[model samples]
Target chain A: MALHYSPVLWNRQKRLYDLTMAGLMALYLIIFCTLQTSLFPPITTETIVIRATSTLAFLMLHVILVIGPLCRLDNRFLPLLYNRRHLGVSMFIVAAVHSVFSVLQFHTRGDVDPLVSLFTSERQYGSFGQFPFQPLGFFALLILFVMAATSHDFWLKNLSPRVWKTLHMSVYLAYALIVMHVALGILQQETSPVYAGLMGVGVLTVSGLHVMAAFIGNRRELHPNAPATDGFVAVCDVNDIADNRAKTLMVNGQNIALFKYDGKLSAVSNLCRHQNGPLGEGKIIDGCITCPWHGYQYLPENGQSPPPFTEKIETYAVRCVGTTVWVNPQPYPPGTPQTPALLKVTTINDEN
Target chain B: MTPPLRRAHRFIWLLLVVALPLGFLATRPTKQSPWLQEPVLPPQSTAMPVLLRTIDADSLVLNLRQSVRGTERQLEILLKQPFETPSAVVCIRQEGSRRAVGLLNAPGLYRFPLPTGTNRPLVEIVDDVHGRTVKTVQL
Candidate 1:
């Protein structure tokens, strides 16, 4: 993915994505400020900036968390997953703004340093309702800063995907810390049920989506069929896949999407290169599998996007006998074109 | 973007644009709210019979108190302790007249005699160093 270690690739898609992200962020801030001023008149500039940046960062974090399981549920969501690191970095910047402003507002001009005062402002560690929440947020911000700084492929390559992914997984811990920070900090002070309810909804939506995706994945894996013979496996009957759609199967420890398109059957790796989106959940459009998340398309025969688009996925050989479709689970090199297995006349006749 | 994802993006934007304003409106502080309102002054005490309020002018503490005698409640004013300055003026407002009562730097309490039948007169503690009323209290 990296030709050289030059900052970013700066492709059209990435540029467009970043532009959209920036627009949304601006919109959110504008709305937040307008409402805050309109309702609570004579608001201080520091308070406005602190609330606006913190809320924007919180919303961005929710979006980032949802993208992962969303990609799992449908490959069409992969486009959002493609450049999610940018969102993370943006979130960290906004959060940093909030952090700096908070320290200046509440902790400065004291006997202690700003950072030191943040922790020492209140000594209610044993009390949950009166806990000193700034420390929790401070630690969470530190984790986000680390993740954002090391989000580039340079770190990914050096750390390896497993290590990189594991490190990034600390986002869950950060999220939990932030939740507690809000719970003990503003929620305790504001005592507004609306704020509490919104936070509850956000937590539920994120957790619910992840649980649902995991459940679906586990259910599919529990299926005892699709036993491999030699290097190939009988995935399903041709009719099991609807026209222009795909049936996902797990074979040889690899997830595969068997597509039935234009009276031909083809197999490709289920994971989309962009975000590991479920390719099988996508539908064929214009003879190319169009992912549901961001509309990234790949031709089934070659597991490659049409020329001018360099994205590709691993392809597999497929065959049909009667109504049964057999797929060679061994994946070919990405973009390798293979002849499609046609549905036999008897299979069509039997269906008719 | 496909129809569904496009719809979702629009929905999210709409929610934030609409819901955020509503949230702010809902949680808006009232004029009477403690955080937004000016802090309440401590209640005047009846147990002491004569309320004494301290006015801090730089490092100096000017104690202003009131006393009831016969038919008149006199305004008593003094520096909590002795000061380096020998002479200072304390102003008392009574019967629509402003009178300057001189105070000595000699330490003990100084009482300001007012016209009989006057009740709860306003006493102003002038700054000994600056020659201006630094604090005002009704006694």
Candidate 2:
């Protein structure tokens, strides 16, 4: 969205989002610390900070993991996805504080270095019940640190979207590591079943939402059952698509988004140039296809962003024979201008 | 997301759905280890001897004896066999403060002068190499 990279591209929404996030984090900390002190009078301040920050970080991670699926299930959650990088970075900072405090409390005051002591402190690698869990936490924190470091759009541009996305996908691995870190670490010592039950619920909710979202997304994908004639695949009727909206079609291994607007039909690759968002889910705003995930706009005819922007997507040759819209599965190069298929006046009048 | 990424996501979640609960259930404490369980304070009788065993399978045992000598109480660690862990050391924790007493690698008696006003001190055998407490006995 930015032509030049600044430290951050802050807008009114981003400012409000950050302020709300900070306020909620501060409030959670106050409530957690107050309750922890009242319930466990013998607990030390160091332990309280460690527990509070760790729990907060873990909760934030669950929220981050669910936002994508939530947004997929309902577009109303897109706002949460917009500023998610800030939440991720904040979670990493909290996790780092927890890690540092834990090391200082448990690993310091020893003859060996704190890092070395952390690994050597517990020699129960062979025992499942007594395995050393700190190293797992350390590795998970390392992954989060990498993700937080590369969260900027600058990295996204330099690394290319595919590489960047693949790197960020490792968040799932990090989440898995964190789950085991909690399961094998403090859960072993804590006698309360409430902690275990809460953890189990968190795991189930995160996984369940992802599975549901994937199922919905799969159902939305349209695959042509009939073979193509002369490289043109009959996708759907012109009336099947609403004005300014698109219907996604899969033909000849190509994912296409066929858009109907002003009695004209155009087909373009469903994959948005930015973040590979499903362009078919977006609407034509101001005569341009606006990506639902991020408002990255592209001209429907040329599959190119408007002036002052350089992003583009592959366009397909499309035509309407009597009201049945057919699209050539072979795609033109990105930004290739294609003639839109105009609907017949009688057909438009009949539908009206 | 691409089809491959979606497939990977589904596979990962499926694995987690099965693995997470299993891992958590496996972590449940079937029987509490002696070192992890609540410490039972021994009676303040000099005649009664307290015995502690290492957490590992080595079965290394140490007898703790408390005796009064010249108006001062002394705690002695009598090891029946040499410690299997060469870096093990005997430590005393009293009133939230811990101090190493002596090495337990030798199969002999080691004595440490117990400070006056020490109450219900916990005796521990720590493996310095691993930086873990291997045994604990409360007195």
Candidate with the greatest TM-score versus the true structure: 2
Q: Write the residue-wise lDDT of candidate 1 on A69-133 in tens digits.
A: 78767757778977888999999999999999999998897679898889888787886556678
User: Per-residue CA lDDT of candidate 2, range A102-174, in tens?
Assistant: 9999989878999999998888789876677899899999999999999998898899877787899899889
- Please give the distance, in angstroms, between residue A204's alpha carbon in candidate 2 and its true position after superposition: 0.8
DockQ of 2: 0.31
Q: What CA RMSD would you report for each candidate?
A: 11.0, 8.0
CA lDDT of each prediction against the hidden true structure: 0.72, 0.81
Give the backbone clash total of model 1. Answer: 5
DockQ (Cα-based) for each candidate: 0.04, 0.31
Question: Over 4 Å off in model 2, which ranges?
Answer: A345-352, B29-139
- On lDDT, the leading prediction is 2
Candidate 1 chain A minimal-lDDT segment of 10 residues: A215-224
Q: What is the lDDT of residue B11 in candidate 2?
A: 82
Please tell me the TM-score of chain A for candidate 1.
0.79
Tens digits of per-residue lDDT, candidate 1, B18-89, equal 443344333333212323432322223232246455555543444444465354344444455655543455
Q: What local lDDT does model 2 show for residue B88? A: 74
